[model samples]
Structure formats: C-alpha cells, structure tokens
Target: MLSNFDIPLLLGLAVLATLGMVTMYSAGFDHGSRFVDHGRNMLLAALILFTVAQLPPQRLVQLAVPLYTVGVVLLVATALFGITKKGSTRWLNVGIVIQPSEILKIAMPLMLAWWFQKREGQLRPLDFGVAGALLLIPVGLVMKQPDLGTSLLILSGGLYVIFFAGLSWRIILPVVTLGAAGIGLIVIMGDRLCEPDVDWRVLHDYQKHRVCTLLDPTKDPLGKGFHIIQGMIAIGSGGLSGKGFMQGTQTHLEFIPERTTDFIFAAYSEEFGLAGVLTLIATFTFVLMRGLMIAAEAPSVFSRLLAGSLTLSFFTYAMVNMGMVSGILPVVGIPLPFISYGGTAMVTLGLALGMLMSIARSRRIMQT
Candidate 1:
C-alpha cells in the first residue's frame, strides 16, 4: 500500500508531478483537456505503483523470467504483424494498441538480475557473454523496429544490471573507449560524413539527419534543424529569471515545437528559467539518491540489482531527454519522465518505482 512507500521518495515524486501539471497547464494553453488528462494519468499511475508495491521482492523475482520470455515473444509478433504509423512500425494491434519495446525496459533488468542471482558466486566470463547475448536479442529487435529511444532505454537498463552484478571492468573499459572514440571521429569528420547525399549505413535517413542537425542546426533551419534550433532559442531566451508562468513568448508563439511532449523541458525552461530548471534537477537527484539508498538496503542480490538498475535507468531516461532538448544529443522521442505527458511512459515509471518500493518495504520488514 501507499503506507509502505518511502516518505522522501514519495514527497519528491509528488513535487515533480505537481510541477508537471503546472507546466503542462501552461503548455496546453487551455487548448484541450491535456492538463486534466495528465492528472488522470498520474492518478492511474499511482494506483499501479501502490498495487505493484504490495507484492514482495521474492514475488517480483519469480515473475521476472516469465515476464521477459513473454515480452520477447510479443516483440517477435510485433515484428511480423505490427501497426506502422509515422514511418515507424513500433506498435502492435493485439486487441488494443501495444508497444512491446516498453516491456523490455522493465523486463531486461528483471531478467538479468534474476540471471545473476541464479549464478551467484559461480560467475565466469562465459556467463557475462551469455548475459550480453540475452541483452542483445531484445535490443536488436527494438532497433529493427527502428525505435532508437526505446532501444537505448532497454539496452541501458539491461547493461545496468550486468554492471551492478560485478561484471569485470576489463570488458567494460574497452566498450567505453570505443564509444568515446567513435563520437570524436564523428565530430572530426562531420563535414564529410554529415553531407546531404552521404549515407550513414548504420542509421536510417531520419536518424542520420538528427545527428547532423545536432552538429549544426542552422544548416537546415526550416527543415530538419528547426526543432533543435528552436529548442535552444527558447531555453536561451528564458534567461535566469524566466518569462514567468504562461508568459513564454517562444511557447505562446508556437516557435518551440512539441512543447507538451519530448521538448516540454524547453517550454518549462522558457517559463521558469535557470532557477526552475535547477529545482527540477534537484528533485530528480533526490529521487535517484533515495532509490540508491533502498537498493543498498535490499536483502538479496536480485533485489539490489533490480532496484539499482531501475533507479539508474530513470537517471538515464531524464539525462537523454534533457540532453536531446538542449542540443547536446540528437533529438529522439524519449520523454522527460514525470514531466513529459504520456500514459505509457507514466506506467513504466510507476512500475519501476513500485518495484523499488516493494524492495524497500521488504527490507524494512526484515529489519523489524
């Protein structure tokens, strides 16, 4: 129940949700019922969190493999027969609309945590190889669906589990070095590599465009670069003091696109400025720290890894969204956690936090 939830975590989430509502109200500009619907989504998400929290961590571990198995099967079905909209075939029409990749975000960590727990102290390099294979399968499917943002989320969540389970640094270091080197090379050869006629074989046309736009948004001001250019302008125009609530000129004038979704942070920044942005960051940080505390107190390896991965996954989600909006990263469809308005993303957040609460509650019970 709600009574079992950690107090500080709850308070921080409450403040963030309230702030989301305020910013959403302004973002909507009374155009539709988005503010009210967002409130409804929050309520529904809370109910899910509370219900899921009632289960013990043991129960969650038990559900892990089966949930993962089923999620992967669904992804396969989605691949064969899925709805295609906006040039991406990510959703499946199984009686209702379903995006299977979202399942892997939670399932990936659950499955990995359980896998490591089963192996326990008998760990070997082969086990890590097997784990990497497991992570890659679902991630590869999601990528084939061409949903870069969700793929990253699943990849990160699974990798976090592998990381927290004491995977060797020798393997981790090389991958990190390669990724950094790849980024540096891209920047160095951006002029030639990012040309209009050039084909970045690894990425789709739109994906390639986003990377180029990130390097220099002004190149295609009225086309692909428009979103990033406008987002930065809105953020910069806000200044330190902001334009006051409902007073963001860029937002009100419709210069900042997608003000209620992926780019909502820019609208919020335009309205509340640097001070408000700092407050949001602080609240998110508090939530992450409290989550880590719970992870540390968990009784079992499965519980600890599951909790820790979920917590850090939230950090990744927020950072990616904020980075994309700020022009530091390519624009993707990742939402800003509680601050972004989306029912599906809200449910994912609720499930993760609810499981964290369940782990924390189990620890408290054990202590007594």
Candidate 2:
C-alpha cells in the first residue's frame, strides 16, 4: 500500500507531524496525556489515509452526493437537537459527541466538484446559481452554530471549487473589491465601532470581541486580548535562532494559550525560531506545489477540481492559523494543519491527503 503512495507528499506530511510532536511535547509539559493523544490522533489519521488512498476518484465521486447530503442533514438535526457546550451549539451526541461543521470542510469540495463535473461543458448563470445555493445551505447552518472558523473554511473550500470551474472575474473582482473595502471600513471605525455599548448586527458578541481585540490587543490586555498579546510576545522573543527546544519560557509560564492546538505555532517559534519557521513553510509549499501538479495532470475534471480545492483548503487553514497567531488576523477556532493536536482535524487532513494521493496515482498510471 505504501508503494503506491506519493513519496514526496508523504515525506512532507511526515516532517510536519514530527514538528508537531516536538512542539506538543514542549508545550504539554503539565499535561502528559496531550502528547500521547496527539501521537494517537496522527497514527489514526495515517491509517485512515492509507485505506482511503486505495479507492480511486470514481468511487469517491459516487460517495460525494450521499456524504454531502448526510453531512447537511446531520447539521440540521444538530440545529434542532444539538448539545450546547460553553454557549456554542456545535456538538451532536449520537452516542458520541462530534462536531458536524467539521464534516462540511471536506463535503463542500466533494459536492461542488461533483456538481460542476455533471454540468461540465454547459455552465451558465443558472448552474453557478445552483452551485451557490448548494454551498450556502451548509455554510449557513454552520454559521448558525456560531462556529465562524469552520464556516469560513467551508465557504473557502466551496469557493475554490467554484473558482476552478471558471467563475468569471467579472463577478469575482467586485466581490474582492467589496471585501477589501469592508476590511478598510473596519480598520477606520475600529475605536467607535468596537465600543462596549455598540451592537454588531451580524457577528456574535464573542466574534465581535475577537475582531476588536485584534485591532487593539492592549485595550483589554488582561482579558480578551491576552492570547494575541502572548502569542506575539512568544513570536518576537524567538528573535532568530530560538530559545532552544523545550525551553520556551512563554509556553512554560502559560502565557501562550492552547499551546498544543491553536497557538502551537507560537510555541514552535519560541523553540525553533525563524529558521524553523522558514523550513516548515517550505515543507508546506512543497506539499501545495505537488498537489497542484497532481491536480493539473488528473485525468478527469472532477478529479482536478477536487484535488485543487483540497490543496487550497489546506493552504487556507494553515494561513489563517499562522495569521491569527502572528497577530495579523482575528483569533478563530482554526488550527495549524498537521501540527494541531485534534483528532477530528487530523482525520479531515488525512482524508484530504488521501484524495490527493488518489489523484496523483491516477496520473502516474496514465503515464505508465
């Protein structure tokens, strides 16, 4: 089974996972179980990846619609009968607690790729309109769960598929401009708009607070801003060469929150510094580039769209996590790909890698 796998991509994943274990060990000094749990999740995901890679793209396409439908139905059920924990109705307990929004991350690209493949040659406004409807249904449900990070990922994943299927820049440019304008407006009105008395109509209270905290972490240094401040401090203190492995003071002192999960990048920086950061970035770049080449050479349109979208989805997840930790973006529930210590995310990433493997393997067979 390993013989059929894409060696370069697997090697890149291996390096990232090794980096994750080292950082998790240093960051989880107090909680020994976290290190073990992280390792278990990685191994579990590896097994899943191995099994999934055995299937070809056609079988995956056959599973797409049903999987997407089930995922959305579960999301709706969750809306009606989901368990609320810490004020977020994100988990469903069907004998075991699971987050349904995570399903959308993979399902979005699958469903969209299938939709476009079916309508391959005769795409029109109606087709794009139908695609948008398909995308928004689950994304809207996830946002209703108030899980903004997952919602964003699903939206981006679906959008990537749509874009690959030739969504015109005539429509894309205006949306991009509007997004830029919206960011500018937020920056300009940061002080007044973030006032305690003001109400953000669209965003949840905590979500609004996160944006405000991003703009001015010093305003609530001891409260809402602590995570960003500490993350940046850990990053800055790393300087160039780092403080040495397992000796990150910020991580040891507990200033960096969720050190084995969302903020693991900071802990990594404090120990490995700038050189390690560049190396990690290069490894991810290799994975992304390899994925793009595989997508380009895929034998079918569905395979191409699915593979390309999954690659960009990984990029988006990693970029958002890094940006938030670097204090350039608001804190979201996103975790660094392959480096974050969560079972579900590791599995999702594994499924993605398996899809890439299946796509790349198809190309190799065609050439041979």
TM-score of model 1 (CA atoms): 0.98
Cα lDDT tens digits for candidate 1, 1-368: 35656888889989999999999999987558878888888998898888888899989989999999999999999889999888888999889999999999999999999999999989998899999999999999999889998998999999999999998899889999999999999999999998778888889998888898999999999988999989999999889989999999999898888889899999999999999999999999999999999998899999999999999999998899999999999999999988888999999999998999899888877886
Off by over 4 Å in 1: 1-3
Candidate 1's clash total is 0
Candidate 1 lDDT score at position 25: 94
**lDDT scores in order:** 0.91, 0.91
lDDT of 2 by residue, 197-290 (tens): 9999899999999999999999999999999999999999998999999889999988898998999999999888999899889988888898
Model 2 lDDT at residue 38: 90
How many backbone clashes does every candidate have? Answer: 0, 0
